[model samples]
Target chain A: MINPQGLMIVLSGPSGVGKGTVRKAIFDHPDTEFEYSISMTTRNMREGEVDGVDYFFKSKKEFEQLIADDKFIEYAQYVDNYYGTPVDYCIETINDGRDIFLEIEVEGAKQVREKFPNALFIFLAPPTLGHLEDRLIGRGTESDDIIKNRIETAKKELEMMSLYDYVVINDEVDAARQTIQSIVTAEHHNRKRIEQQLRKHLLEVD
Target chain B: MINPQGLMIVLSGPSGVGKGTVRKAIFDHPDTEFEYSISMTTRNMREGEVDGVDYFFKSKKEFEQLIADDKFIEYAQYVDNYYGTPVDYCIETINDGRDIFLEIEVEGAKQVREKFPNALFIFLAPPTLGHLEDRLIGRGTESDDIIKNRIETAKKELEMMSLYDYVVINDEVDAARQTIQSIVTAEHHNRKRIEQQLRKHLLEVD
Candidate 1:
């Protein structure tokens, strides 16, 4: 029998929905076994950020070369900086029977879907749209106009919730983390996903 | 917004696959919140079995009337004794926002599928056909011919496993129980199932 591949879990949601916080909590939990797929970026590394741990720092020329070679599952240009998920690492990790976790933006998630259609897509949602707006406003660093613009973007992102396989309401970080963990566990037991392996085992017995 | 309905979980598997044992363990656990759907039957009450608790003992006439009235979700006759699951209790419990759990034979589960197409069906499978055969033979009380017949039936039932949403290997009772619990927890967070309610909430916020 062939070796079973690991699952690709993509965690994404509207901005200000605490996707990063919930993701941090999930990875911090002792039980998390998924290999995090560190994103690559051409942007300058900020103070105290590790070269490979926080983000894979790449030169603009190197990043453009990777895009040309189709080495990224998804890539986007923002303010003249290229950011993307490298495809080779994700495929290699999954083929090695280790689940790969990707915390990315909605557009990146859509690109991942096109490349890995069977990957698990989980949308982290706010308890309500009002809750999302409050969180956006609660961040004191942003001006009122910036907050309003962020709220508009959030509303549009929430509409894309339909694209996700599961929605973990980020009302509480721990609760969302647990839900995501359980989803991965349950997905492993899904008949559609594991049937072929079991069928081969049964035929051998026969 | 309309109140959300609870999920209907159907646990079924081949004969002697320990469906009853696992169901008992699930109910015995303090964390199980699903309402058990006690089957109605026309079979004579055993010395220790109590009506309503063990079974909803009904007269042959009442059983026939129920069949005619379509009151049962599924029913079958064995050795002139009628046994079945009632439809009303399941509907009432789900409508009350409480999950209802049904443990039944594969045939009864198929019948339930025709009615509750969206119900979560978990097929409890043996670890292997060899393991299943050893279990059947280990019973010791059954004659060789009876055991042979049971093995044939089990094979056919196993074929129907593709009809289920999830397949759980009954390798260990406790392990299977935990997987099942996780499946239910993850299912509650499924985007397709809860999207409507969240959509309504979002619309109200807008």
Candidate 2:
């Protein structure tokens, strides 16, 4: 049987919801087989971060040129820095029967949804709104007003949880990582995705 | 948040696809938590098979009366014996926030689908049509004609694979069992089923 196209998995949630932590745990685990889609950014590369490994660093002009060329699956500007996921790598990886993982913000996730509606969208959620507030406060550098503002933003972002296919409560990083892995495994067994190949294999032989 | 209603998991497949073996492996595993809905049958109980353990052995009259009273989720007669899955046990179990597992025939699975459209339908499949034929032939008791007929029936049943939510290829009992377990875990995280409670918890706090 021919190999089916791989899944495009998007992990997105509200800011400070531990998406980065859970993503790190997932990649650090030896069982993870999917390749991470390195993001492109126009921000200045920080010390200890490699240009290609950490991100495909680009200049403002170069990033805008790629954007104008429609090479990004999703992109967003934060604090005057442009960050985007390239469309070519994702498409090539999926076509090669290898899953590609993307960790992006909510707005960028929405854009990917428009482009690849079938992509598996997992919303990493906080255990509770109170817990999210505590996490923001725990950062300690932000003042009370900024923490309150972040909580409000989180509320709005949490509302978008309905848009996701699966919701993994980030109460514990390891648990969230395991749930994500299980979701990916189950998706491969979904009948809608694998039916055609099984059908051809079963019926044609008779 | 209130515990969500448990999933109704229906495991069905073509005859001789080793559904019983896989189901046994699943139930025998320490991690299996779902309750198996013991089937009611009018078939004579064997010496070692205890009532309510192997099956809820009932008289033909009792089985027919239960059928008339709409007590069964699905029922069928084979070789002058009645067999069925009782509806009350499944309903009560799911209502108690516990999953209910039913191992039934494909036709019975189709009936359950009409009654409970949201139930998780898993179709166990042989590795290949040739493998299915080999399994039937390995049964030794069946004549060549019976084996051929069984293979034809299997082909027809495999056509119904599209009706399932997930298809588990029974290439190995342990692998199929693990896949089923993963599918259940993933279904619990499905956003459609858990979104309401999450939304209420998140939005109401603000």
Q: In TM-score terms, which candidate is top?
A: 2
| TM-scores, each model vs. reference | 0.90, 0.91
Q: Candidate 2, residues B112-190: lDDT per residue as tens digits?
A: 9999999999999988888888887876756788778778888889989989999989999999999999999999999
Chain B in candidate 2 has what TM-score?
0.88
Docking class of 2: medium
| Top DockQ prediction, candidate number | 2
Alpha-carbon lDDT, every model: 0.85, 0.87
What digit string (tens of lDDT, one per residue) describes model 1 on residues A55-163?
8999999999999998999987743677789998999999999899998878889988887889999998887788888887875556787777777888888899889
**Which regions in candidate 2 have their CA more than 4 angstroms from the true location?**
A42-61, A140-146, A204-206, B43-51, B57-59, B78-81, B141-145, B204-206
After best superposition, candidate 2 residue A26: deviation in angstroms?
Answer: 0.8
Q: What DockQ values do the models have?
A: 0.61, 0.62
Put down candidate 2 lDDT per residue, A109-133, tens digits, no spaces. 9999988998999999988888888
Model 2's TM-score against the true structure: 0.91
